[model samples]
Target: MIKKLFLLVILCSLQVAVAQELSCTVIVNSDQVNQTNKQIFKTLEKSLNDYVNQTKWTNRTFSVKERIECSMMITINKYENSAFSGTIQVQSNRPVFNSTYQSPVFNYQDKRFTFNYVEFAPLYFNPNVFESNLTSVITYYVYIILGIDADTFVKEGGTPYFKQAQNIVNLSQGSGYAGWQQTDGNRTRWELVDNLLSNTFKEYRLALYNYHRLGLDNLVDNASLAKQSIAGSMKLFDKLNNVRPNSFVLQAFFDAKSEEIANVFSDGPKVDIVKLKETLNEIAPLYSDTWSRIKY
Candidate 1:
């Protein structure tokens, strides 16, 4: 029994030493690429998965169960020589407290991804320098996912991670990458991080903490009070919408949250849905159809 305990302690220590923060699944869809050989795509999918899941992106320790759950769907719409153009759908979710339910924290699609990749090339991330487009782009989203997840637990706790993503954006500004520049379009990586760190959009960050920590996490204990807190958190967006109407982060929040929000109030112990729906509509007018369905 003593020997078994010693072995278990050693195993736990080993896991602590090697536990990376992200549990990412990567899928590279190259159906649009007219390549006959499919070995390269398979290699890319594995490389990306290994790269993201193996890299220790932060100083914080995460057990296997605590690692952030996320996925990157890389759809290569065009490929020629070593150049590849694609869109990446990045998503992440956090487990609600006292329940098995996983709440969607981020669901965003980056459309301006264009990178060059050689099969079997090693992917490495450096904070101070602009690595290749493939490395930088994926790293940016990784930090964004980490940042938003942190924000859900603590007010503006994601600042450090968001700043890491900002560093990548600043370093990659002139690298000719489509998503790293201001002119890369409104939905580029540059804009996303900028908006996140900018003081003008702090409400969205605070609301994230309130919604999860103060609301969803308490649902099992007090469903009605939790729904009220969630509604109160949603009202924060109304203030943000008035200051910066129809912002990217606002849209990003609803993109992940609309369905969940609708369902949360629809079947709960009950709250003022009329006011909650108004707040939802005010902040995310695009999700009006979703808001209209919220009852009780």
Candidate 2:
């Protein structure tokens, strides 16, 4: 019985060690701040790195290799007393099946991030409650990453995670924070989550699932069929754009996928080139230059 108990404890410890969902790198840049003591930024970077990497954000157990790959770059624009104002660039990616390539899932820059932090202080976050702005913002993006990664694997699988992010935005309302309100900007946290969860943009989410799983994942097995599927998925964006012209979600999708779409079709059949160019230009005229590189 003692031997069995010892083995059980070992298994539990192993599970705990491998359960975190994100493998994220956090950078704190304070070059814009004219401060002599820059050690605080270094401490902030390490603290955020530990907070994101070590914290378990989901119930699903993940092996070290399966953790979601993501990054956050915080550029401290100004420092006054204990308050810091900065912009955060957040990005996350997923590995394409049967390939060494990774696809960008989310890439956004939040310019209104302002927070208060003390050197060496622990960063704390609770999904149900609004805590410090620093932790809340980090946690919000973490769920967004998880949601987008899951949606690529399963249809609308990101709904719960997006809802979790919405809850963070809801709890943060009236906190006087810059990015939590609908009026903050077109690309505010509230608007992003709202569009993801709304039925009006359901096609956008479905297109993401088809684009990644049905399309990209099958390239190694059948390039022609995969390209066809990816082009079909791109058509869904036209539907989304028609419903809401130039929406933030539509722009965000193209922002992450423009170059990828070009590279994927850079050497495809003549039929695919015609179809892709027509559909892509119709939906994303902003990427005409990038798409022009695709050869028939």
Candidate 3:
């Protein structure tokens, strides 16, 4: 019995040591709702916190420090009985190579988040099954975060994970959810992942890999070359824009990267400044003011 107990302890320790891929901070805000049963919100918060942090969403093993840092803020707009409706804001960041700074990879908001929650009920998610909209939506974004992080490491490394997210969308076709359908809007979850994985957007994904792994990661060793590599990657966005103008994916990229891109070129070689400004205007004309701020 002593030996069996020791073995069980070791197994438990091993399980605990294998950290999940995401170190997500989940917040359940109920300020919009006028309710006396605030305890349910507290319970929901704890449950979601556990669901996101404790569940293993990928096959890769990550150390506590290596886990991807992300946050999901779900603001409750309405709460009636066990039903909750709200919006979710999600943001994720990846650490730069050999630097203390982290770069934002994904920042998005889901304005239509409606679901039913039972107090103290378990939040279950299975990629093969379409369970609840809450779990499905959360799982979808989790995979998206993973996919974006993966792309920064290797060229198209996020393809498999994006496909996984696409599968969730496909399975959720009959889910009657707002964000799952293409007709919902161009910025819907379906369009985001679909554009990311589609051939028309291949250059954009390639640019992501180059911008991170080849450009940012090499900045410490060679700033000029890194800037040039990053510039080359930026040009690909122009190509992507030519193919699919005003794409949701392109807008999303700028949403997370505009500031960083501007800063990176603010004091670079004079030639790069001209090229970057022209490309920035051509591809992301929406951010011309931001790009114009870059020092020539």
Instruction: Report the number of the highest-lDDT candidate.
Output: 1
Predictions in order: lDDT = 0.90, 0.89, 0.89
Error of 1 at 223 (Å): 1.3
- Candidate 3, position 190, lDDT: 91
Point out the worst 10-residue segment of candidate 3 by lDDT.
267-276
Clashing pairs in 3: none
Q: Model 1, 76-136: lDDT tens per residue?
A: 9999888999899999999899998989999999988889889998888777887789999
Model 1 spans with C-alpha error above 4 angstroms:
none
Candidate 1 structure, TM-score to reference:
0.97
Residues forming the 10-long window of minimal summed lDDT in candidate 1: 268-277
The order by descending TM-score is: 1, 2, 3
Q: Could you give candidate 2's per-residue lDDT for residues 167-280 as a string of tens digits?
A: 999999878989999988778989989999999999889999999999999988988888887888888988888889888888888888899989888775434577779888
- State the lDDT of candidate 3 residue by residue for 226-260, as single tens digits: 88889998889988888888898888889899999
Error of 2 at 20 (Å): 1.2
Q: Write down the TM-score of every candidate.
A: 0.97, 0.93, 0.92
Name the regions of candidate 2 deviating beyond 4 angstroms. Answer: 1-17, 268-271
